[model samples]
Every structure is written in C-alpha cells, then in structure tokens.
Target: MNTPDVAGATGYIDTNFKGKAEKAIQELNDGCDFVYIHFEAPDECGHRRETQNKIRSIELIDELVLPVVIEGLEKFVDYKIMILPDHPTPIKTATHASDAVPYVIYHKNAEIVSGIDSIDEESAKSTNNYVNFGPDIMKKFLGA
Candidate 1:
C-alpha cells in the first residue's frame, strides 16, 4: 500500500478551507488520483459551543471551498468524491459524540436515483445505508 502524504494548515481558526481546496486541486492537476481535504473549523466551533460560528464555518466551506473543488474535478474525465466528517461534535455537550455522522459519495459518471435531496445526518439515516465500521466506508468509497 502507498502511504498518503498529509498536508494542511495547523491552527484552529487558521485552518483555511479555501487554501486546502486549492491544494487539493493542485494535487489533482499534478496527476494525483486521490486527494483528501479536511476542514476543522466547524469541529472546533462545536467543541467551543459556538453554535453560530459553527454554522458560519460550514457555510464558508460550502461557499469558498466545495465549489472550487468541484470545478477543479470537472477537469478530470472520471472522479469520485466522498465528503464526511470523522465524527460528530455537538455544541450542547462541547465534546465528541459516538453517534454516526453523515457522508456523501458522488461518482462523476454514474446516474444515481436515490431521491435524497440533501446530505446531512438526518438524510443519511433516512437512506438506511449504514456502515458500522469506519474503514468500511473507505472500501465503499473506493468501490473495493
């Protein structure tokens, strides 16, 4: 197995989603078959119980990062994207929860008719497709 190279910003609020997205795009342009981009602001906000900031952080990711990455992915003939949080950090408890988190696996050329209008905790649960083990999700994402 090939060891993945991990690179990103390190500070709490300084974890720049846009920069990370750009790096991911660059990796793709440089012939990388897979790139993982992680945004930590929302998790940090959840841990600090900053509910509004958490929401805003998620919004920033949607606005400043995902679109850029999606556009970058368009340059490729085939690509798969898997978006998910490692775990849930509820603002009420200001700590990590063992509850399952939502995930989205999108294939570029496949026609999916799942009828799921959105990707979120509730929506993922509504699909009734749960992977009990974490690594299993990676296998599923890679079509292994």
Candidate 2:
C-alpha cells in the first residue's frame, strides 16, 4: 500500500516498503491465502542514466534489502518462499536485457526434487515446462 519512489529521499531500495509488506503480511496472517510485494527499485536502478548509481543501487538491494526481506518473510510465513526475477538487468548495459534471471524457491513442507533449488541456467531450463503461472500453477497444485 505504501509504495515509495525508489529514487526519492527514502531510497526505493529502503526497508520502508519491506516494512509495509511485513505489516501487510501480518495483517493478512489470519485469512489471506497469498501475498505479493513487487519492488521495482532494482529495475529502476538498472535503467539509471548514470552507471555508478545503478551499481550502487544493485549493491544496496543485494546487501541491505534482500537479506532483510528474506529473513523477515521466513520469520513471518510458515511455508514456502520463492524468489524469482521476471528478467535480468545487466550492469554494464545499465538496462534490462532480454535474459532469463535467476530463480530460487524454498519449500518448507516438500523436498525440492527439481525446479529452482539452485541458480543455474541448466536447472531453469530443466524445470521450465513444469512451472507455469496462475491457473496452471493452481492446476498443478490440485492435481487437476
């Protein structure tokens, strides 16, 4: 709900949004089935006109925001946690290149026999067919 500009006084990569997300997760803890926090700081940073700032932003996310989010989510949620970027943003290009980003998912209940346990291109390719979004994911879950 509190979506802050990544480039504003409070950096987009700040824990402000993450705190909001955590609060939202807590608020919905009783009844909600799912939640999604799509922070666009990384994307914005990737497209920055300047090079150093972009790299710094990436480092900030990787160093500060990411660990906190992951740790906080794990503390709050009881089950699986999946971390996947829609695409990759190259540092050199300072732009989002059409490249498959890394994907990793941690499931608490079931052992991960396949899919993105580790971040490798070959592994992603291997499990691409098995993983789909929305209705497909639901179908897969329900054995439909």
Which candidate ranks first by lDDT, i.e. highest?
A: 1
Q: What is candidate 2's CA lDDT for residue 35?
A: 49
* Per-residue C-alpha lDDT of model 2 across residues 23-130, encoded as one tens digit per residue: 545545545545455656666666665556655655665665566556655655355555555556665687777665545555565645653455555677776644
lDDT of 1 by residue, 1-144 (tens): 233343556535556677788888888898777887767888999999999989988888889889999999999888899999989999999999989999888898884778899889999999998999988999999992
The true-versus-predicted C-alpha distance at residue 88 of model 1, in Å, is 0.3
**Model-by-model lDDT, in order?**
0.84, 0.55
TM-score of each: 0.90, 0.56
Clashes of 2: 1
When summed lDDT is taken over every stretch of 10 residues in candidate 1, the lowest stretch is 1-10
Candidate 2: misplaced stretches above 4 Å?
A: 1-11, 15-17, 49-78, 113-144
Show the colliding residue pairs in model 1: none
- Model 1 regions lying over 4 Å from their true place: 1-11
